[model samples]
Structure formats: structure tokens, C-alpha cells
Target chain A: MTDLEAGREALLDHVEALIAQRGGVSITLAELAAAAGMSPANLYRFFENKEALYEAVAERWFAPKVRAMEEVLASDLPIRQKFYAFYARRLGMICDDYARDPALFRSYLELGQQHIEIVRGFIDLADHFLAELIAEAIAEGYFPGLEIDSAVSLVNLMLQTFCDPELVVMLIHSVSEEKLAIVVDTIFDGLRGDRPSNVRRLTRAAR
Target chain B: MTDLEAGREALLDHVEALIAQRGGVSITLAELAAAAGMSPANLYRFFENKEALYEAVAERWFAPKVRAMEEVLASDLPIRQKFYAFYARRLGMICDDYARDPALFRSYLELGQQHIEIVRGFIDLADHFLAELIAEAIAEGYFPGLEIDSAVSLVNLMLQTFCDPELVVMLIHSVSEEKLAIVVDTIFDGLRGDRPSNVRRLTRAAR
Candidate 1:
């Protein structure tokens, strides 16, 4: 990467750490400038305002998440494995990122009209990727005779359930990682055309 | 209902309407009392404080939603129908309630710990109902050879998607009722055991 690109990334890292510590409420451009060892005027050369910096931070945080899914989508893995890996990676990234800096999560949630459309555009991109993946899976008989639209919606629902701020807050407070994994597995098992035999074994054990 | 019950219900209704109009930030007990043709001191007999009154108003609004789901669960409708009806009712209630009072939705989103617990309890109840319905559906061969736990999780995921605040906010702003209905229907179809022919028709139309 170019020196300027490296500097931009370093600035974003500093901003994310600060935002996480402050819960996205009290961020000031001066503080960010100081943290990045740059003058406020110099910082403005990179970002117009605090909000622009925030948008950059959000973009930086979400880029890896989208890239991870793209990697899974492009892999030669079976459709079920591809879908599961994509979602699991997404969920794990979110959980790990939130654990490292919950303020970033809070900031994303607080994004208003200025960023909402941009965020929605990214979401639409993800949705399109997912829809195509589902279509390909069904066409290849990896999932038997699945309806494309419903499958897309189901995947969207699954993503929402795992990423829901309220549910995630509660789950992180009281739920174990093992249990969360099981829940994710169960959700995918329902979505997939074929069920693993161990699913029955696990169900019986739970009972 | 008894006269006291009737009077209490009337007071709660007045308070809800006032809060709806005033965005829950400006409504005062005195104003509510005046609207109900009672003294502010008399209003105190019905609610201990503003928070308590707000909780009561929320309870009054949500009680029917709970009742409707409970009734569906208890009724003899097919599992698919029961699931569809439950979610349809839930989405409708959320949309209608938000239309009447956006503050009510905001308040619920910002609910304190005690209220969060109440909301969680409601979610757990719905989860249990979904589990039961899925179990029955599997037993009836609606989903032949289905994994029950996974199916239950998927159902929960579907329900959660409908109520996810972030997604709801986006949909409310950008989607029509017809589009929302399609979203709901597609999700349920995805969860259904077999691919329905109508999915292709819908997908083509959407394209």
C-alpha cells in the first residue's frame, strides 16, 4: 500500500479505539487529531469533520467483514459449507470486533441519515451476494428445490437474528459461546436441505 | 369488567393517547388527568409515577399482541398457518403501534433493565411456542426428516428478523406494505419444508 494509504489506515485504527472507549458519544476531532499526532487542520485534510471520520471508521471496520464473506463465496467449498462458513465468519467477526471495541458497534447503530443510505447500499450488496449464492446452491442441488426468494429472506432473517443489537447484548451477557455455536448450527441445519444424523443425537441429548 | 377495572382501563387509554400525541416527552400526569376528567391526585391512584404509567401504557398496547399469539398457539390451525398468522400479527402490531406513537417504539428500544427483562421474557415465550409448533409440524410430516432444534432456531430467527429494530426502521422508511408482506411471506416460505411453486412466480415478478 502507498504511504498515504498506510497513514489513513493508522488514523482509522486510532479513531476506532477512541470511539470504542468513548461509546461513540464524546468524540472530538481535536482528540482524534492529537491521538493521530496530527494537527486538527491536517486531520481535516483527510476528513471534513468528525462525522466523516466516523464514516471512514465504519467503512474500515465493515470492509473485512464483507471481504471475508466474499472469500467464502468465491471458494470451491460445497454450497452448505460455503454458506455456513460465510455466516459463521461474519458472526465471529462481529462478536470479536464488538468485544474489542463495543463503541464501534454503538457508533454503527447510531449512524443517521447521512450514513444510512451508504450503509444500506452495502447491505444491499451483501444481500445480492447472498441471493446469488442461494440461487447457485439450489440450482446445483446442494439444497434440494429451495425457493430462491424465500431462501434469500431466510438467510437475511438468520443474519438479523444473530446480529440484532438487543439479542446480542443479552446473549453476550448470559449465553456461552458453545451454546451460541449450537444455535447457529441449528439455524443452518434448518436452512440446509440435508440434516446431519448427529442433529437427532443432539436433540435427544438436549431433551 | 368491574367498575374499578373499567375506570382504570379508561385512564390508561387516555394516557396512551396523550403520550402518542405528545411524543411521550411532554405529556404530564396533570394533562392526562385533565383529559380523563380526574384530578392529578386521582391519577396517582392509578400509577405511581411517570415511568410506571409509561410501562402500563406499553403493557396495555402489547397485551393484545401477546394474547393474539397465545390464541393462535392454542388454536387447531395447521402449524404453517399458525406460524404465518403469529408473525403477520406481530409485524402489523409493530407497524400500527409505531404509526400511532413513534415514541412508544423508541421507549421500548431504550427500555431499562427491568423492562428489557420483560421483553426478553416475551421473546422466550414466543420461542417456546415456535419450538412446539415446529415439533408438531415435523411429527405431521410437513417437514419430513427435519431436524427439530434447527427448525426451531430458524423459526426464532425468522420471527426476530421481523422485529429487528434496525431492519424495521429501514423497511418502514423505504418499503411499502406490499413489499413488507412479500418479505414476510418469502421468509416463511424459506422455512417451509418444500419449495413452493409460488416462489418462482414471486421472484420473477420482483426481478
Candidate 2:
């Protein structure tokens, strides 16, 4: 990378470390510069303002998560196993963030909506990955008599409590480890229910 | 009611109307007095400050809803039908609030957390009602092979997106009429899945 590019990247890294320590409030140019062992004026050379700096920090925060999730989606594991592994990784990441720095994680999530477009992009990207898995699950005859669209939204609702940082931060205590596993199981059971082997639930839609 | 009691009730009623008209911002002593055809000093006879007045307003807002919900819970409708009716009523009320006064609804929800104890109490009450239906559904052979505790939280997760005003405000368009019905169907199908007729998904907890 060019010197300027490297300096910009280093600045983003420093900002993230600071946020992990102090949440969103510490992103002032002076603090970031101090964290980087430089003057605020020098930091200004790399970024225009706090918002620009925050945008970069957000992209950095989301990069590895997106990559890991995409990897899980693209794998050839049986659909059920794939879904379990994906959420396991996601739940682990959230717990680690909260444990490592509860204050930062909470405040960041509270203010996270300020980066709405970025967060939306991540959710959209994750949704696209999950959509692929849902299609495969249906094709495998796992979700019999279910429309793909409905299944997609159902998965979104089922996973929202686990995946949304804002909700996670809010209900972190209420959603326990055992509860997560059980909800995942229920969703899978519901997805895989009503084959020739299981009892049939008369469709309310049909009624 | 005594003459003073009648005056207090009138202020609370006036406060609700104004909040529904202008949101939490309208609860200021001056605006409330102006809205109620009384002096600001006289208003202090009833409420100490905005916070106190808001707590009362919040309670008043939740009381009838809670009563109606308790009535729904007390009814002997079959579990499946009961669940549907409760959410339908809740969703309809929320949609009406959003439609009737989008600004007030938004502001109220934004400041809604200020009355955290009252809101939490309402949620706990509603949860108690839903818990009974969940237990009944399990007993009625509707949710075959599902744990009660897990089922309760699953029900909460499933209904949260559809009912949370904050989420509704954020994802109102994303959750369309057709999708809501379909998701509700999926939950039911999953509930009824894995009976003697279907090959049961072995409990993951066992594994």
C-alpha cells in the first residue's frame, strides 16, 4: 500500500481498538491521534472528520464477519449442519464482543444505527447468503410445502434476536445459551416438519 | 370520584390526547396546562414534573391494552386460534397508532424507554399471558416435541418482529401483509410438525 493508504489503514485500526475500549464516544480526532501516537492535526491529514473516520471503522468491524459468514454459506455441509455452524459462529462472535467490552459493545450498538447504510449493507449481504442456504434446504426437500419467500422471512425473524446487535444488546441476558440452541432446533424442526414421516398440520393458509 | 380525583383523571385524559397528537414533547407543564384549559400552577396540583406525568401517561396508555390482553388470555379459545387473535389485535392496534399519528407514535416510542419500568411491566404481563397459551399449545398436541421454556422464548422471538413498535417503525415495509401470514403459518406448521405422523427430529439436546 502507498504511505497514505497504509497510514489510513493504521488509523482505522487504532480507532477500532479505541472503540473496543471506550465505545463510540472516544472517536474524537484528538483521542484517535493520541492512540496513534501523533497530533490531532496530523490525524486530520488522513481523514476529513469524525463521520468519515467512523465509516471506515465500521467497514473494518464488518469485514471479517461478512467473510466468515459467506464462507459458511458457500460450504457443502448438509443444510441443517450448515445452518447450525453459521449461527454458532455468529452467536460466539456476539458473546465475545459483549464479554470483551460490554460498555463499548452496548454504546456502539446504541449508536450503530447512525451507520444505517453500512449496517443495512451487512444485513443485506448476510440475507443473501442465508437465502442461498434456504433455497438449497428447500431443494433438498427439507422444507416441504413452504414457499421460499416465507421461509426467508421466517428465518430472519427466528434469527433476529440472535443476530441484530441492537436486539442482542437489549435482550442479551434474556436469551440464554440453552434458549438459543432450543430456538434453533425449533426452527429446524418447523422447517423440516410435515413430511410423509411426520404428522401433518393443516395449513391455515389453505383454510 | 372526588372533585380533585375527577380533575386528575381529566388531566391524564387530556395528556393522552395531546401525546397522541404531538408525542412526548407535548407533556411539558405549560403545554399540558394550555391543552387542559388550566393554569401551569394548577397542573402542578396533579403532577410534579414531566417525568411523573409521563409515568402516569405511560400507565394509562398500557392499562386498557393490558386489560384487553388479559381478557384474550382468559378466553377459552383453542391455543392455535388464541395465539392468532392476540397477535392480530396487537398488530392492528400498532398499525392504527402508526397510521393515525406517525409523528406522535414515533416520538412516543423514542421516549417510550423513559418509562422503562412501566413498559417492562406491560411486557412481563403480556409474556405471562403468552406463556399460558404456549403451555396450552404443548398440552393440546399442537407443538409436538417442543420444550415449554424454549417454546415460550421462540414464540416471543417469532412475534417480536411483528409486534415491536420500534422494529415496526424500522421494518414496516419489509414485513408485508402476505409475509406476516406466511410466517405465522410457518410457526404453526413447525409447532404441529414431528408428531406420530412425521419422522420426529430427535431432540438436539439429547445429542
Candidate 3:
């Protein structure tokens, strides 16, 4: 990377740490610059204001999510596996972000409708990709035929579950990557047109 | 109702209306009393303080939700339908509250962990009910055998979609009882062990 790019990345990292620790209130451009071994004036050259700096921080975290979705969609994985991989990767992104710095996650949540709309657009992109995959899978007889709308709705529902604040808090108290995987698998099973072999095991266990 | 009961109900209604209209900040004992056609001093006879009154208001709204879950669990409906009804009712409560006063909903979100934990407890209650229902349904041959833990996680995931702020916001923009019903039906269909006939219709329509 270029020197300027390295400095920009360092500034973002410093800002993310500060935001995670202090939420939205604690960080200032001067502090961020000082942390990066630079001056406030130099920081100003990079970002116009606190909002710009914060937006850049969000973009840095969000870009990877967009890329991950794109890669999953472009991959040759079966529809069901693709869906599971998508949710697993997405949830991992959220869990990691919350663990690293919750304030950045909070910042993303507090973003204006415009920013949310952008995020939603990306979600829609992911949803459309999944919908297409499901349709193709059904056509190929790899999965039982199912309604695309309900399938998309199910995918969206699972995604929302990963994003729930209360669930995040609960997970914090009992953090388990395995449990998260089970949650993902269960959702996929519930959404599928056919039951997995473990369905009987689950039912018997329930009884 | 007795005079005291009637008066207290009136007072609570006014508090709800005011909080819904102007938010938590706009509420005051004097204003609530005035709106309720009672004296501020008389209002204190029924409640300790504003916080107490707010809690009462929440209880008034929340108790019915608990009762609804009980009714769903006790009813003879299939486990999948019961789960759908439970969440659909919960979503209805949120939408009703949001419609009555956006500020009140905002207050609930802003009040931090105490409020959020209360909400989570309600969801946990629902989860327990669902876990039992799934167990019973499986035992009775209503569903294909499934892992109890995985089923509960899936149910929780599907339920969370109804309460997700982002998804709720999206729904509001295109709000309709019909649309909500469709969404709810889609969810139930997705959850059912047997695929619905309309799955093909949904798939084609979504694309």
C-alpha cells in the first residue's frame, strides 16, 4: 500500500478503537491523529470532519461485508450451502465487530436513513442473489421446489436475527461459536423444502 | 368499573397518549392529570412518580402479550401455527404502539438495558413455550422429527425478524395488513415440515 493509504488505515483503526471504547462521544480528530503519530492539521487533510471520519470507519468495515456477499454469490457452491455460508460469514462479521469495538457497530446503527438505505441496498443485493440460487437449485432438482418470496423472507429473517441487539447481549453472556453455527444450521433446516436427517433427532430430543 | 378503577384507567390512557405524542420528555404528572381531568395531586394518589407510571403503562401493554402466548400454547393449533401466531401478535403489538406514538417506541429503545432486558424476558418466555410446543408437535407426529435445540434456535431466529428495527422500518414504508399477513404466512410456510402448494407461486412472484 502507499504511504498515504497506510496512514489512512492507521487513522481508521485508531478511530474504531476509540469509538468502541467511548461509543460516539469519546473520539476527536486530534486524538486520532495523535494516536496515529500525526498532527490534527494533517488529520484534517485526510478527513473533513468527525462525521467524515466516522463514515470512513463504517465504510471500511462494511466494504468487506459487501465483498463477502459478492464472493459467496459468485461461488459454485450448492444453494443450501451457499445460504449457510453467507449467514455464517455475515454473523461472524457482526460478532467480530461487536467483540472488537461495539461503538463502531453502534455508529452503524445510528447512521441516518440514507446510510441505512445503502446497507439495505446491499442486503437486497444479497437477497436477490440467494433468491436466484434457490430458484436454480429447485430447477436442478438439488432441492425440493419452494417459493422464492418465502425463501428470501426466510433468509432475511435469519440475517435480522444475527443483527438483533438483544440477542447480541445474550450471546455476550454465553458466547459460543458452536452455538451460533447451530443457530445457522437450524434456520437453514427450517427454511429447506426437505428435512435434514437430524430433524428426527431434534424432534426426539424435543420430546 | 368502580370510580377509582375508572379514574386510574383514564389517567393511564392520558399518559399513553401524551407519551406517544410528545415522547417521554413531554410527559409530566401535572400535564397528565390535566389531560385526564384530574388534579396533579390526585394523580399521585394512584402512582408514585413518572417512572412508576411509565412502568404501569408498559405493563398494561405487555400483559396482554404474555396472555396471548399462553393462549397460543394452550390452543389446539399445530405447533407451527402457534409459533406464527405468537410472533405475529407480538409484531402487531409493536406496530400498534408505534402507530399510537412513535416517541413512546423511541423511549423504549433509548431506555437502555432495563427496558431491553424486560423485552428479552418476554421473548424468552415465548421461546420456552415454543420449545415445548415443538416437542409436543413432534411427539404427536405433526412435524418431522427435528432436534429440539436447533428447532428452538430456528424459532427464535424467525421470531426476531418481526421485532428487528430495520425490518420494521422497511415494513412501515410499505405498511399494510395484507402485506404483513403475506409475510407471516410466508414465514409459517417456510417453517412447516411439509412444503406448501403456494411455494411455486411465491418463487415465481419473488423473481
Greater TM-score among 2 and 3 belongs to 2
Separately for all candidates shown, the number of backbone clashes (residues 3 or more apart, or on different chains) is 0, 8, 8
Candidate 2 displacement at residue A73 in angstroms? 1.6
Q: Write the per-residue lDDT of candidate 1 for residues B1-207, one digit (tens) a residue.
A: 987677779887776566456543545677888899998888888776766766676577568887988887897765555656666567777777678767766655554233565556566777777777777777776544347765665545545556555356545754333333443343333444343223223324434
* Regions more than 4 Å wrong, model 2: A1-6, A17-52, A145-147, A191-207, B1-6, B16-31, B34-52, B144-148, B176-178, B191-207
Candidate that scores best on lDDT: 2
**Which is the leading candidate under TM-score?**
2
Distance from true location, Cα of A121 in model 2, Å: 1.4
* Candidate 1, superposed: residue stretches over 4 Å from native: A26-31, A48-52, A111-114, A142-151, A163-207, B24-37, B48-52, B98-114, B131-135, B138-154, B163-207
Candidate 3 local lDDT, B74-144, one digit each (tens): 87665545655666566777778778767667755554234565556655776787788778756766444
Candidate 2, residues A167-207: lDDT per residue as tens digits? 87677776654555555555666654234311113224324
- How good is model 3 by TM-score? 0.70
- The models' CA-based lDDT, in order, is 0.62, 0.71, 0.60
Chain A TM-score from candidate 3: 0.61
**Model 3 alpha-carbon drift over 4 Å, by segment:** A17-22, A25-55, A74-76, A101-125, A128-139, A142-150, A163-207, B26-41, B49-51, B96-114, B117-121, B142-150, B163-170, B173-207
Candidate 2 per-residue C-alpha lDDT over B133-175 given as tens digits, one digit per residue, 9 for 90 to 100: 8788778776777677657677787668877778877777666
Q: Every model's DockQ, to 2 decimals?
A: 0.12, 0.26, 0.14
